[model samples]
Target chain A: MATTNDYLKGTKSVLPILTGLFPFGLIYGVSAVTSGIPKVQAIAMSFVVFAGAAQISIVNSFSSGISIITAVAIAGLINLRMAMYGASIADSIRSDRLLTRIFSSFLLTDQVYAVSITEKGKNMNTNIFKFYIGAALPIWLTWQAATIIGVFAGKTLPSWLSLEFAVPLTFLALLGPFLVKSHFAVSALTAGIVMVLTRNVPYNAGFFIAVLSGITAGFLIKNRKGDR
Target chain B: MNTSHLWAVIILSGIATFIIRFFFIQIKQAPLSGKVKELFSFIPPAVLSALVFGSVFENGLSSLTPRNPYLWASILAGITAVTSKNVLLTISTGMIFIWGWNYLY
Candidate 1:
């Protein structure tokens, strides 16, 4: 059973990931502003879209003169990975009501999913749904605030500060923990190589290719080990 | 971008994202097969690596060279993260190294 403390615990568990995400939010806000997106639209993008990578992609599309439909399509494609996340975590949240599921799905970004799944493994006795909400709300609120702050601070920040590096740095922090096992290490290396190889591919198709091939390699390697 | 176009992109993309996230949750009857289970287990690592590589190597294949501070900083950050498992340490170390590299060269 989940007590109020469990919910608070969930919020606490998410803090580490949120710390890494803080810079990412700032960069996204700065990107939106510098990319010539209107301030209101950029802030609204955070409220409405709520996904960092996709929001960046949208801003890139705008600056590059890509059509609005194509921009939206790219955003949709970028977020297709969230479906994989939903599929993987479906069982953990199967007990949630439709309304809870509907609302919570809106909060299913990469960071939140990673922490919540980790928490689920560590504490199976807690209410996963309530715990998820407790974690999600803080991240949602922080991201929105960070974007607004970035919009205001974007112009003044120096170029050499290299705040953009924080995005990849945050991913490194998340990726490091996943290297606990050999197959996971293999997956990360293979995916990273594939992503680099296909970097010239347009419209983020390389991302999809890298993810698909990496997962395939990991699966095959795991099965090969199992058979041995 | 105009206001209507901006709103359209935001709302449409938002709806698409919501649908993707909600689709599998609504369909709970089918259990994942063994192969699918293995595949899903790798998604987190695979997806994150893809994202990190994409950013760290912003110039694509050319970024593997010695000139890129991002490459070196990421290497350092990865080591710190794997060893310490601390978020702040990883980001701060990476940022500090990049800032120093930029300052020096």
Candidate 2:
């Protein structure tokens, strides 16, 4: 049976991620509304696409009068990391049922993936899939609600708050725990350097470049550390 | 965009996203060398860092100068992240700093 400590621990892990996600939800709602997408369509996309970055990309591209094909392409490219995330969780869960696997795939996101991986590594006996769902479902629901709130009330909210910064802040919080080690530190630095160097690449392809470069750097550092 | 075009975008994005996800999962059978595994591990931090920097900075084309309070706030946030090991504190402090700076300046 789950004890009070278990509940407390779960709440501790889940709340921060939800808080971080709140700003992005608000941004999506406001942006979608401002971009001329009907409220229902905007709300629907949040559930259907179920990705913050892709939704933002779609809205931004549409607002700029870019072709839908190009917009979708850009959004897809931005969210390619979800594939890695899905695969990572799939390996961990190792569920035989295809339906369970497919349903679980819908819950994969950056925050969910990071939290799940860390939790899986920490708790060997715990049910990894359940933990992932526990972490992910709240995030997904919170995102939808936040978007709707933003859509309806974003304009009424003061500009002084500048809810846009909330996304970066959330990511900062998510990434904070992972940087406890040197390998992670160097890798993050390398990624930042590469991203800055390739920042001008069109369609945000630079994000991919930064990810690849950082991964390569991290591998090298880890190997060198292992050798020592 | 028109309705047909929007549907096309959604369809294309869904397909592309599925393919990218499937690519990683399909590779589970392949044996990764130790060195390669080590290298791939860095991808998350590197990719995330780059994206973070890109988000904080404007125009994606400019160099990092300390002209903006956002950068200052981020530095403070980074420091807080390293010291306290608390995500909430780091983010809240960073946001407050940025908000206050924007308010004052």
Candidate 3:
């Protein structure tokens, strides 16, 4: 049983990342409303889905009159990485309680996973689940609040300020830090090429292609290097 | 506006997401080789880049020509992202560039 201090310590480590994500959440709220979701539904989705890419995909698909099944499939595919994040963090939690593991896994997101992994290297004995919850809960609440604000404001918000730009920029900021390795660069380039080539693929299947291509390139490159 | 349809989407999407997340939980005990770990590491950057590029470019499936300055502004923003590594700076720069482009042209 970790004390409040332990939880605060874990939560503090993630504050900076959450700060970076705030604007993106705000923008998502605005976009979700503009994309034709009712203000209440838009805000609710932020809390329910709690994944930016999937929320956007679901909203976009619904607004465009795509079938519900297709929307779910696309959103599911985009967020498939969360499962990997959960797997990576599972080793850090020594808990035998199924409820604890399930709750912690539910909060798993890219930022939480990254921050947890980075922090785990420094504090090996820390309660990773507590830390993960402390960090992610704030982000989740903020996302819901921001989406509500955006929904209420709707198109009344200025286009010039453009919160939509925040989403890509956040990714860019996050991606820049990970580009130190040449293998990463090769993988990204390969993915980009494949995405462009398959841009016309229906139902946004290009995203999966891009992911597969990048993973394949990265795997092959790493294997070749190991062989050498 | 259709509540039933919306709920269906929500439930289906939620279930799909849960299944994907559960896959990783189920495999947590397995040791990932170095190559597999490296491959997983690449997923974020690759998927992100594809999404960013898709958002920036219009008629991306059809034309490579710079028919719109919004696209140019995004390119500049991408460069800013790579160099500055500041999310606020890149977004503001792109927003201003596109607004100015829209105003001028």
Note the DockQ of each predicted structure.
0.55, 0.43, 0.49
Candidate 3 chain A minimal-lDDT segment of 10 residues? A165-174
Clashing pairs in 1: none
lDDT of 3 at B31: 62
CAPRI verdict (incorrect, acceptable, medium, high) for model 3: medium
TM-score per candidate: 0.75, 0.69, 0.83
Better of 1 and 2 by lDDT: 1
lDDT of each: 0.80, 0.69, 0.69
Q: What's the lDDT of the predicted structure labeled candidate 2?
A: 0.69
Q: Cα deviation in Å at residue A55, candidate 2?
A: 5.1
Query: Which stretches in model 3 have alpha-carbon errors above 4 Å?
Result: A1-4, A60-70, A159-174, A178-180, A203-207, A225-228, B1-7, B26-28, B31-33
Model 2 interface CAPRI class:
acceptable
lDDT of 1 by residue, B3-96 (tens): 6787888889888888988888778754557666566678778877887888788778999999988889999999998899876689889999
Candidate 3, A224: how far from true, in Å? Answer: 3.2
Candidate 3 CA-lDDT value: 0.69
lDDT tens string, model 2, A25-141? 876787677666778777877877888767766665565555766677657756766765665566775467766666667667788778878877887765666777677778878
